[model samples]
Target chain A: MKKAFLSTGLLLITILILPLFISPFLVYLSTEILVFAIFAMSLGLIMGFGGMPSLGHCALFGLGAYTVAILSEYTANIYLLLGAAILISLCFSIVTGYIAIRNKGVFFLMITLAFTQVLFLITSRMKFWGGNDGYSASVTANFGFGEITSNMGLFYMMGFFFVLSYFLLKLFVNAPAGKVLKGMMENEGRMIALGYNPKTYKMIAYLIAGSMAGLAGGLYIYKTQFVSPALFSVHMGAEVMIMVFIGGLGTVFGPALGAGAFVFLQNYISTMTDRWPLILGLLFIAIVLLKRGGILHLIQFVTTFGLKLFKPSRSRNAPVDKQVKGKEQAS
Target chain B: MIELKEVHSYYGHSHILHGVNLKVNKGQCVALLGRNGAGKTTTIHSIAGLVVPKEGAIAFKDKELIGKTPNHISKAGVGLVPQGRRVFSSLTVKENLLIAERKSTSSEKQWTIEEIYQLFPILKEREENMGNELSGGQQQMLAIGRALLLNPDFLLMDEPSEGLAPVIIEQIKNIILDVKKTGLSMLIVEQNIDLACCVADEVIILNKGEVVWQGLPNELLHNEELLKVHLGV
Candidate 1:
């Protein structure tokens, strides 16, 4: 517990001071990472905890982006835009989740993919929303404080939301409802026997994930000052899935770390070579083969290995060792 | 407190249960005895709403349960301890128990975490151990403890002694008796006649998706002809 606190504190301090040492472009990239991190984390909740795999999570993200874009044209009231983004995403998820959640396994995946495709088609064809060219309208609202005209101000705003989202999501997964969702994932029959409607819990998870994704989408538009039909594309959805897989599915902070790594790699590699995706694909394959539990598991393995190497006697006196000893004595 | 009237369940063109009827009165233990493929598990599944019946009515405390979902059935005060001890393999023993914990609506005493620890001391000892880390007997105890945490008026146990050793089966028998003393109605499906007779107030023998015999435990013990023909004991 102490170690977790220390690491969290260290991470926060590092992120806070990142812009001070880095270039303006890197700050912008950092904001992008945070946005995608929230997106990946939302997907992770449903896929990892609720055992409901969705291929159209980008629909929620896109919906939020479009809501913010359209709303910003009339009024730049940040709160209104954010609220509308979340509300729109919630409505979309409820409608889509009601239909998609009924199907299990591959069917669920297919249904979600179909829904996203439908949204993409609508967004691209609708001329009122700028059609295929998308919308790049400037905002007037000052996120409740003042005009966030500067990149640093925008970075701080993104950081604030990132921290808030992280804590909220962490609280959610550790709550009683979250535990039931995990139980549902493990054994839906058992959860039903225990008086938990799996569908209700699943729908709740879907809503939470959708809202979080919506928040990310709102932030995405604020950071880029644009909204495009590409936001709802299948490729973007696949990218978030890859990020979740690279981070670790169930671990709360894994997706954030995954998004950071993915954004950094994508940015760095794209600058050097057009074959960056080939390298990214190889890296994903390696991670999957070597560390099935993702980067978090890999980090854990390394840390434990380092600890054992540094303090062999401490490892011998570990609680697990004591348990084995107690069992041997009993037998 | 639970009754099934001519419950006819099907599994995609195959009629698994053919008008099966059973009952467990308040504070009573009724054992459904049958050989493999005799629809014993199907009967329990039907009660739990995992296998919805095609026809006939199931009522728990006079409320129709046929059209209700499994979770709704559970909330209506019916708990199921499924076959294979389907405890959450990824969760710890404590987590498994806590997730299933629900307050009893009736005036009956609630089953607290401490009480469960008292009943299964091993679980308390391995509170942090993952479900998959436990032994078969331990998993069965966890499964029973999980169901008890729901604080249900009726419990359905399917093959509690299917894969356990004789010693563990004996322990399970005592546990069932203790649970019965708590005034919870139970419908236990079992192939082991000894375990069935040990805790049951009545015995039901099923063959080919139909109840062929129903009698007192002592009556079943004395009727060797009935036992040999139906159970092949």
Candidate 2:
């Protein structure tokens, strides 16, 4: 109950207050942060819950971006643009998930990485895929509902997607099959012994995660109006891992928080100095050492401590004394 | 009935089983008695399609089962409770059973959720507890209940009593007998010779991955010298 209250309060504050005060540059950055948060959360659903760490999620993300970029270039219809991207991503996710799920742990990770790298090379070399120069993305015509080509309007769309994606992820983890995936992570042998074939369930999770990453990519193309080969880079995979860890591995809200903090750090540092990667490297280590779990745990600690200091045991004086007296009598 | 003939197996190049043969007739409780690393578990795995047999044939009711997947073998009415009680640790007792609830192949005798809970009453009480929350004995019972829910004609149990309390072991033996009364044949791998001799009708002794002796439980019990030679009991 307390958690729900806190989260809702934070949500209201972020929705109403932050955009009012923060500069447009920071808002733009926040928008990027939220998009990446969706991406990170999707990957974490597989890594943290399903115990399948993927190094090829960028492939799915890039696929989504390219799909949108390609379709939007040819077609002005918004629904068609989104439809093509989603369908393409879903197909890629299914195929990638099938081959990857056949292996366990490190092998699964390696095979996924191989698939992504192959995809990267394909995108870099193919002529129709725009080769290494990449493709120019175009915005949809709003289906004759006037041009929705404004930055603020696009921000709201991205924010809505972020919220939708987050809730969908929560629903999945709470479902019966999702619980089985968690069980598989804890003890796969036992799940098999129970006669619940985990392979099928895990494959479904991988596909879902991949498709979400793709959806995020599709939104990313809409926001930026460009799609590039670097979207599938190895560095993007590492950034995703960092995002999940920074947010707090399994918490629902952690991914968004991590994305906000991380993207802000990158933007702020890049403006101040060219040593942003160096700064990120140091912060990553400190977070691992200090928070252990992630920034989410640190935030939780601070919230509780701040509450305790402000209240200062004022409500418990009479009840506490009575409890002490009662204990004394019992003794 | 199930038969494994001249089966050989290896674990990453180390030969584990060499020329091992065993059979269990329908409605019989057969036990494989061996010390650690005696290929008893390996033999069960081979039959369950978990491990591939290099030079042998496994026939279940005279049907070839060598090249099939684990699910196919399971579908063929061969249920295995593996060496460790590998109950899904995050699932509740009820969820564990529900997850693997396959309808009985025969149209007339489907194993329902209530029937599984009836076989193990403790499961009904702890239906909502996570798999790891159960006691060692409870986990063992859950494992057996899980396999039985598949309604297999034959059950292969590997070390179901290991690490369990004696009282729990007795419960397991009783459950085995109760299952036996229902005409489900079992291949039991056990180091507990006393429990094996009690629950099993026939005992097959494996030594160094080779079958050294096979006889009635009474005859095997009477011959202590042979038991010591093969089983190191």
Candidate 3:
């Protein structure tokens, strides 16, 4: 309990302090990272604990955004739009997860990818959804149920959702069903042999993960006041996966850091080169080769080095366990 | 308590079991003995619904099992301790037991975490350790403990003594006999002929997907030439 308090306190400090030092552009970028962070965390719940490698998270995200877009087009009430988005997105995710989770591993991945790819193609060509041009939501204070058109409000909402997501997911992973899902990941055959069905656990995980992604997506579209097919692209799915991998998955908030680092690098480097993708690809190769764990890992490595240099003799009195505290090689 | 009649199963194009038949009365300890390539595992898999039979009927207390999925079959009260003792490696011993839980049907339930701990006290000691960290004997204990938590009436244990030390195997054999006192029926698939002969209420020998012999353990002992001729060990 003490550890949890300290972690939350540290998170609160970062949330309060980071915006003060950074420019509004960086604030906006980090807000974008917050949305991605929520998405990646949702994906990690299934991939890391539920053992379902879902590549169709963006489908759920896009569905949420499009649901809000279509509803807001018809009705201007912000409360109704938010409610409608949640419901519609949840329904869509449950249906998609049902189809996607029936098969085994790689097949599960392909099925999810296939479903999202189809959605992306339809969004690109469909005129009703604004096609590739995309739909811009109304953002007036009075025009749409006291909608906060200001960027700060949007950032606050994103951050709130990020914190909410982390806690909700933490609650879930500790639940009875969550334990079963983790057990399924460890050994499904044994689970079956022990008189427990693994399929139900998988399906539940898939649906919950889908709903989480949907909530994040809805928040995202509201923040941007825009909806696009790009939200459903394969790239979005890959980006979420990269966040999970880099976040040192299984630890809460790791994916958020991963998303922050990825977005930060992209923002700073794209200013210098038009071919940022190629450079990013090479960097990915280097990360895998270096086995750096992730950007947070790199940060840890450097921080330790700097701390050691600053007080070379201080460690003589300090505890050894404190140095590498909480740093573990995830299985 | 269990019956399989005219059970035929095929793996892809290759036919495995051909018109296999077996039965276990309540509290009966039946052992399915065979050579390495014989259909003992497949027969167990068929009864457990891990493999759908091409043609047959699997009835546990007169309810059909062949058409059901593995989960539904398990829910119907067939607890299988499968080959390889496939314990959930990432889960702790406590968690592995927790996942196979069934709501208590009786006001006085026979099995609880306490009850299972009594059955395999070694599991109680390693409750915090991950399943993979345990030795083979401990894992086998965990596997049995996990199944016992469900409190099923029948257990289908595959290869309980497949690769354990002799002493551990002796302990497991005692555990099996102790469990049988609860009136739980079993269809155990074992390669250990000595252990099988000692406790099995009846022995059924399968030679290549066909049941060639069925009798009491004493009768099986009397027919040692038949066992030597067929089992090859």
Candidate 4:
């Protein structure tokens, strides 16, 4: 546990120093990655832990973006705009989640997608909200300390929220309630027998995930100063889902690593070719076919393998030690 | 302290339980014996609120439980050791126990993790192991322990000795007896007649969802004609 904290601290320090040496464009890219990392992690909370695999996660994200964009015209208070965004998205999740949670498996997925499509149509065709051209908020976010107009400032703010979201989710996942959620995922029947309302837990997870996704959306608008129908698009929803899978399905930090890897690869590849999505699709298929529990599991495997190599004699004696331990316990 | 009167449950359109009625007195262990598709499990499910009965009254300590959700039934001091063990494969042995842990409402003894560990020492030894890693008998023990942690006044156990060796069944029989000693009333559904007769204070036989016979365990063992007709023993 101490080792985990130390490593996390080191990683944070590295990220903190990275922008100092990198270009402004890279800082902008990093900000985008952090925002999506928050987005993907929110999706991960429900999909991985709550066993609610949603395809309309970007609905909350888009709603958050749109809330901030529209609310900024009336008020420059960052908290109020962002708070409104989170609140609106939470309300959206409650309504949709109430209906969607009644169905399981494919039905749940289809219902969430159907709701996202509803939001997509409203945003895309409304001329009052800029229609297909999308709404661009020209106002700067005031933090009381100063206005954040630069990419570097936005990157640091996102970095802070990214770390906060990771720890918040980690705390939740390790708690007794988190264990119940996982148990519910494995055997809903058993969980019911054990006195846990499966729907209640699933709804709680969905609400939190939606709010977090909205927060990510609120953060996202700062990076682009733009809100488009594309934010609520099915394509964006699919992309976040792909990020969650490619990074790791069940791990807390896996989604962030996934978001980072996805954003970097997409940006790099799209500059070279128009068919970047095809390549991304192929990569996703390859990862799923490999079935190695995503990049996080692969990394874990490598590190453990390296450790085993360093202590070859200990590895050989491990089974013998286990047997002896078993005998001792039996006695 | 648990009573079901004319409880009729169904799966979609096909009815599985037809007007079932039974009662378990306070601090008594009643064994429900029957053949396959005899609605033994459905009876247990009905009480646990897993299979909400379409008709009839189920009262636990005089409180109606027919319309309540499974969790609501569970929280109302009704614990269930469902058929197939139903242990969460993803969680560890300790996690399975901890998830269901609750304080007893009454002045009766509250079952704790330490007490459960004492009851099943093998569970204590394998605390770090996942639920799926345990043997069949160990899983059964874990299932019983998990339900006990709910601190329930009444327990509904389904097929406690469904898939086990003779020795393991004997062990499970003793475990059920020990639980019975705690003054927790239990209505156990069992296929193994011997195990049922060994543990139960009273025996009830169900055939086609109706109570075909109800008597003492000894009387059940003595009545070969009744057993051959209803249970095919």
Give per-residue CA lDDT, model 1, range A1-331, as digits (tens): 3444555577678778989999999998888898898898899899889888888999999999999989887887889899999999999999999998888888998899999999999999999888999988686448557788778877777787887777777777777888889888887877877888788889999999999999899888888888888988989888888898899887778888788889999999999999999998998899999998789888999999998788758435679978788789989
What would the per-residue lDDT of candidate 1 be over residues B144-211, giving only the tens digit for each residue? Answer: 99999989888999999979999999988999999899888899999999999989999999999998
- Candidate 4 docking DockQ: 0.88
Better of 1 and 2 by TM-score: 1
Relative to the unseen true structure, what is the C-alpha lDDT of residue B43 in candidate 3, on a scale of 0 to 100? 97
Tens-digit per-residue lDDT, A88-169, candidate 4: 9999999999999888888888899999999999999989889889999965777799998788888888898888888778
What digit string (tens of lDDT, one per residue) describes model 3 on residues B62-90? Answer: 88888887877777778888777888887
Supply the DockQ value of model 2. Answer: 0.28
Best by TM-score: 1
Q: Is the docking of candidate 3 incorrect, acceptable, medium or high quality?
A: medium
lDDT of 4 by residue, B1-233 (tens): 88889989998997888898899999999999989999999899889988889999998899999989888889989999989898988889998898989997852769999999999999999998999999999999999999999999998899989889899999999999898888888899999999899989999999988888999999999999999999997
Query: Which residue pairs come into collision in candidate 4?
Result: none
Q: For candidate 1, what is the DockQ-based docking class?
A: medium
On DockQ, the candidate that comes out on top is 4
lDDT, candidates in the order shown: 0.88, 0.82, 0.80, 0.89
- Using TM-score as the measure, what is the rank order of every candidate, best first? 1, 4, 3, 2
- Isolated chain A TM-score, each model: 0.91, 0.89, 0.83, 0.91
In candidate 3, chain A reaches a TM of 0.83
Which candidate achieves the best lDDT against the true structure? 4
Candidate 4 lDDT (Cα, 0 to 1) = 0.89
TM agreement with the true structure for every prediction: 0.92, 0.83, 0.85, 0.92
